[model samples]
Target: MLVLITYDVNTEDAAGRRRLRQIAKQCVNYGQRVQNSVFECLLDTAQCRSLQNKLCKLMDPERDSLRFYYLGKKYESKIEHFGCKQTYLPEDPMIL
Candidate 1:
C-alpha cells in the first residue's frame, strides 16, 4: 500500500528543532520526501504501524501535527502532479 505521511513540527525552540530533524530522519528511512514535510511511503501493514508508533513517540502531541493517507495498492491513478519537480513512482528503482 501507499501511505502519504505529512507532519508539522513546532520549531520554536531548540528541542522542537531537534524533534523535527529526528522525525525527518525516520521518514527518510521509510520513504521519499515529496515536500519539505511530506513523505510518500510504500509499506505493508506491519511497516506502517511500526512507523506510526515511532513517529507518535517522537512527536509532541500538543505542538506537532501528523497525518497519514492510505492510498491502497493502486495509488498511481490516485495521484496527480503538475510542477517543476519531476515525480517518480515509489516502486521505481532509485539510483543514489
Candidate 2:
C-alpha cells in the first residue's frame, strides 16, 4: 500500500522543534519526503501500524497534527502531480 503522511507541528518552542525533527526522522526511515511536511511511504499493514505508533508517540496531540492517506495496492492511478518535484514510484528501488 502507499501511505501518504502529512504533519503540521507547532514550532513555536524548542520542544516543538525537537518533536518536529524527530517526527521527520521517523518518517524518513519509512518513506521518501515529497514536501517539507509530507511523505510518501509504501508499507504493509503491520509496518504502517508500527510507524503510526511511533509517530503518535513523538507528537503532542495538543500541538501537532498528523494525517495518513491510505492508497491501496492500486495507487498508481489515484495520484496526480503537477509540480516541479519529480514524481516517483514508491515501489521502485531507492539508491540512498
Count of backbone clashes for each model? 0, 0
- Scored against the true structure, residue 53 in model 1 reaches a CA lDDT of 99
Segments in model 1 whose C-alpha atoms lie over 4 Å from true places = none
**TM-score for every candidate vs. truth?**
0.98, 0.97
lDDT of 2 at 47: 99
lDDT by candidate, in order shown: 0.98, 0.96
lDDT of 1 by residue, 1-96 (tens): 999999999999999999999999999999999999999999999999999999999999999999999999999899999989999999999999
Best by TM-score: 1
| lDDT (tens digit, per residue) of candidate 2 on 1-96 | 999999999999999999999999999999999999999999999999999999999999999999999999999999999979888898888786
Top-lDDT candidate index:
1
